[model samples]
Target: MITAKNPVHAALFLVLAFFSAGGIWMLLHAEFLAIALVMVYVGAVMVLFLFVVMMLDINLERIRQGFWSYLPIGALIGILMLAEMVVVLGSRYFGLEHVPQPAEFPAGYSNTKELGRLLYTDYVYPFELASIVLLVAMIAAVALTLRKRKSVKALDPAKQIAVKRDDRVRIVSMDAEKK
Candidate 1:
């Protein structure tokens, strides 16, 4: 996956990763997450990326120039992640016997319902905070993107609506030019 020269190939690998993740979610019985993964990554994001990659004239050599320079840091992060995973999974340091377990689900228990309940109850504050953060981000984006460009002529609706006939046109009496 590393050293993919073309953006298209990189996008294809991303799509493959998304599909694999979706399949993993399915195996975990998370229908909503799996479906969302498929819809968002496979259906929308990947398609958009493919179109962008195909349409835009990209300078691959320029992008690849700093690859080697950045590799060390990336390799360091990868190693740290690997170490963390090894600590979490490959080691029995924090065995299940030491941790408290939740009550077993009832026979007809639905993951969706449980998730909803947890979201509205235990995780409500964090969820609300996330929504507020997203709202602020959206407002900030709008404020940033919506610049009053001095070069472009912009009309105000109130000014246009309040216009009188004299404000727009005037009848003038001038000597006619006869050839």
Candidate 2:
């Protein structure tokens, strides 16, 4: 019996609650970590979830028709994702080398400051590339949504600009009819 309205409101409330707690966490000196978590999850992931929910229509029966057909592919994708996570997190277990930790900083050095410095100095190119990729994606999305319809009457802006006011205006006067 759960409807769309209930789930949408619940998700909005959850996101609001998360941001409220995150703001408090930031005040408690975990500013960078808290903001990053909020930005990545609440900002990006939640917006993506909302976008997909609003854009796509789902029919349970139609979807269920292909459940068995896609089960093996879905399972394979899931296993690959899990395996990738294990490989990334299990580096120590696999005897891979680790970078030596830097010497402890003085009291004034903040984690956020250090992270920013590293990102700007070492990862700046990759960061710029990511932004360019996002821009291209946005442009592609806009282009995909734009279509020309033959049946619709559309105005040409260039023609409008070239037109004189007299061409579009007409004046007429009506007098009482003679008995």
- Model 2 C-alpha lDDT per residue in residues 1-179, reported as the tens digit of each score: 12224445656776787788788767655679788879987998878777776676756576457667888898899899999988886878653244322344466868799779988999999989999999999999999999989999999999989999789998889998998
Task: Count residue pairs with overlapping backbones in model 1.
Answer: 0
lDDT of each: 0.86, 0.75
Tell me how far the alpha carbon of residue 65 in candidate 2 is from the true structure, in angstroms, after superposition. 4.6
* Model 2 spans with C-alpha error above 4 angstroms: 1-34, 43-57, 65-90, 93-105, 177-179
Error of 1 at 150 (Å): 2.7
Displacement of residue 14 (Cα, Å) in model 2 is 11
| Steric clash pairs (candidate 2) | none
lDDT for model 1 comes to: 0.86
Residue 72 C-alpha lDDT in model 2? 89
Compute each candidate's TM-score over C-alphas: 0.77, 0.55
Say which candidate scores most in lDDT.
Answer: 1
Clashes of each: 0, 0
